[model samples]
Target: MAELISLDRFVDVLQAARREHIALIGGGGKTTLLHALGSQLGGSRVLTTTTVMGHDQHGDLPVVFPTTDGDVARAARNRAVIVWRRIEGKKAKGVAREDCDRWFDLVDHVVVEADGARQRPFKAPAPYEPVVPATATLLVSVIGADALGRVIADQCHRPLRVAALAGCTPYERLSATHAASVLLHHRGALRAKPAGARLVVVINKVDDTSRRSVDELVDVLHGRDRALQVIAISRR
Candidate 1:
C-alpha cells in the first residue's frame, strides 16, 4: 500500500522544494492545484505563471498579470500571486521558459503550469506539449482518479496519444493500470520535465473514485517506480 497523504502534506513538500521553482504537467486540476499552492505557501513570495494557459481561470485574483520584473517584485513581494502575460482571446499568455529562470531571483518560489488538457480530467501529451522550464527543481504530475472507468475518447485529452502510451484502444474505458502506465512513462507525465527535478504525483479527485481503484493505481505506480511519490487528493 502507498503511504496515506493529504493536500496539506503535499503543500509541505512544495514548500520544502524551493530549490523550489515548481512546474505542473499532466492532467486533472493543474491550474487549481498550482494556484492553491501559491496561496498556501505560508505567505512566501511565490510567483505563479504558466507556459500555456487559458484566460478565464484566474478569476479576479490579485495576480501580477503581465509579469514585469519590477511589477512582479512589487506585487508578489508579500502576497500569493497569479502572474501572467496578456490574455489574447481565450488564452492567458505567459512568459518564455527562460524568463521564469531570470525571475527566480525575485521571488522565494516560482510555479508554472506547463500544459493544456482541454478541460479533460486526464491526458497524454502530444509531441509539442508541456513546455516546462529547464530551471524547475520540482515537477508535479497530476491525474484525476475520477477519470478511472471513463471512456478514453470522452474523458481524456489526446485520447489517441493516451491509447498509444497505455496500450489501450482509444474508445475503451480507462483503468488504473492504464493511468499508471501513462503516468509513469517518460514521454507521458514527465514530458519535457527538467533534469534533476524531484517528481511528485497527485491522484486528484479521489472523492469520485473508490478506495480500491485509487489504491490500485498508486500500487502500480510504486511497483514500477519504487521511489515515486504518489498521493491521493480529493481536491486542491
Candidate 2:
C-alpha cells in the first residue's frame, strides 16, 4: 500500500468535529487522500461518480446517484460516501442540490469533492462550478510540487489570473516563493471555515526538485500564524 498518513489525530478531531460534510480541493494527492481515508475506514462507502475527467475508482464500492430515488437512497445507506459528479470536463454536471436534500439524511457522512477545474497550481473559478454548501466538515486542498510553476501556467485553462495573483508577468515567474505564497493564500481562504469542517493542506509531489523541503514554506506559514498544520507527501 502507498505510505499513508496516520490519520488518528484527524479521526479524533473529526469524529466529533463540528462539520458533517468534508470537501477535498486543490491538485496533488486529492484522490490519494480520499482513497487513504476510505481504505482506512475498511468498510462500504457509496463512491459517487464525478464529471471531472480523469481516472476512475477501480474498486467495487457501490455507487448511487445524488438524484437517486428514495428507495435507492435507502439502499445505499451502507455506503461510505456518495461520490457526486459535479462537473464533467470543466462544465457543471449537477450541483447536488436536490440530491443532498434526499440522500444526506440517510448517510452517516458525505464526502464531497470541492474540485476547482482550472487544472493550474494557482486556483481559479469556472462557470457553473459546483457550489457545495458551506456545511462541508472538511476541505482538503492538494498542491503538487511539480505543478508549482510549470503545468499550472502552461496547461491551465487561464494563465493570466494565476500570473496576476503570483505578481508575475508570466506563469514562469512562479518559484518556491510563489508556491509558498499561493499555499498561504489558499490557506487563508479557510480562515472563516466552519468549526465542524477541517481544512487540510496537502503538499504533494515531493519527488519534484522544486518542492522537496517544506521547511521554508512551513516556517513561513507558521511565522504568519502558528495555528496551521501542514502535511507533506509525494504521490509519484
Candidate 3:
C-alpha cells in the first residue's frame, strides 16, 4: 500500500506531468480537480475538452474539442486531449478504438471520463472500453461523498448519471441518507483496478452538511481499496 501524504503531495501528483491520460470518475470533486489541474498546467503542458457528457466545458480549463474521438491521432500529436466519456445526439457515437491505437502517440495526456452517472461505475458503453494506452501513466477515478444518498440525474449542469439507466430504483434527488448510499455504491463499484493502471479516488463534496467528517469516509474508501489514494474535496 502507498503511504499517505499531505494534501500538497496529492496536488503535486495531480499537477505532475508524469501521467498522460487521466480519467476523472465519480461525482463531486471531479470538475474541481480537473479545473485546478488544468489551470495549473494550462499554456504550459495541459489542454482540456469535453464530450458533451456534462457541463465541464464551463469549468476553468479551456475546451479544445467539443466532441469525442477515439482516433485523435491528429489532435493528439501536439496537445493533450480531454475526451468526453459519453456521447450525445444518439446519431453517431464517439470515435473508434482502432484509430486511437494507431495514432495514440499524438497525445501527451488523453483525459477521459472513465464512467458516467447513467451507468454503474467502471463499466463503459457498448463496444467502448477504457483506452488510456500504454503511453498514459495516470488513470484517475473521482467520487463524491455528497452523492451518497442522492440519485444522480441529468440536471443540465451535472455530468452523466451512472444510475440513469442502471435499473436501480431512483432515490430522492439529494438527501443525506441518499448521499451515504451514493458513496457506498460508487466506492464499491470502483474498488477493482485495471491492469497496469494506477488508480486514484477523489471523494468529493466533503463540505456537505451531512458529510463534514472525513474519518469514516476515508476508512470506507481505504477499506475498499488500500492502494487507491482517496482525496476529499468540495465541488459545490
Candidate 4:
C-alpha cells in the first residue's frame, strides 16, 4: 500500500503544509515537482526560485530578480514569479537564503529548489550539498525508484557518496536496502532538514515492475524513522 502512494497524495501533502516556505532537496525530479506544486497550490502570489538551477529552466512563470520588497510585490502582484539573482553562463544564480526568509511574508508561498543533482535519478549528498533554507517549514526529499537494480556508478549523481552511504562498491548493483541506507543516514538525504520543518520522502517514477522494490524500500525507511512520511509516485 505504501508502494501505491500516489502523486495526488504528494500534492495534498504540499497543499496542507504551511509556514509560507517549502524547500525541496535530494535528487530526482525536484524542478518538475517544484513547478507542479506551485501550480497546484493555486496561489496567485506563488514565488518559485532555486538555490541553483539552469538559466533556461524557468518554466512559464515571469522571472524577477528582485532587489527590494516593492520589486517583489510589483512583479508578484497577481501571478507566479520566478526569482533569481543573475544568469551566470548556463546557470541562474539564486538569491541568498536570507532573501527567501524575508520574502516569506511578501508572497503567499515561496517554493525553492534547495539542491542540485545534475539531473540524475538518484543521489547521495556531499557535506555542502542540499542548501536547504533555515526558515523552510517543509522539506521534500526526492529519490528515483528507477535507481534500484542499476549500477551505482552508472546511475547515481554522486556514485562515490552513494557507495559510502550504502556500504557498497561504486560499481555494485543497487538494491532496496542500498537505497534505504542513504535515506536513513543522517548525513544523506536528511542532511539539512530544519528541526521545525515537516519532512516527506518521495520515491518517484513507480510502475508495475518496480512495486515490490518500492514496497521494500518503504518498509526499511519506516522501520528506522517511524515519523517519516514516504510518498511513492508514478509518472503524471
Reference-based TM-score of each model? 0.90, 0.69, 0.55, 0.91
Ranking by lDDT: 4, 1, 2, 3
What tens digits encode model 3's per-residue C-alpha lDDT throughout 113-210?
43344423222122222333343345565555445444444321132333332424343344333333333453333333345656665655455353
Candidate 2 accuracy as lDDT? 0.49
Model 4, 24-56: lDDT tens per residue? 877778888887676666454545555678888
Ordered list by TM-score, greatest first: 4, 1, 2, 3
* Total residue pair clashes for candidate 1: 1
In model 3, the Cα lDDT at residue 200 comes to 64
Winner of 1 and 3 under lDDT = 1
* Lowest-sum lDDT 10-residue window in model 3: 120-129
After TM-score superposition, the amount by which residue 194's alpha carbon in candidate 1 deviates from its true location, in angstroms, is 1.3
Which tens-of-lDDT digit does each residue in 85-107 have in candidate 1? 77788877887777788667777
So what's the TM-score on candidate 2?
Answer: 0.69
User: Candidate 3: lDDT over CA atoms?
Assistant: 0.43
> Which is better, 2 or 4, measured by TM-score?
4
How far is 174's C-alpha from truth in model 2 (Å)?
2.9
Off by over 4 Å in 2: 1-19, 42-55, 66-73, 81-98, 101-103, 118-122, 126-130, 149-152, 155-157, 186-196, 208-213
Which candidate achieves the best lDDT against the true structure? 4
lDDT of 1 at 77: 70
Better of 1 and 4 by lDDT: 4
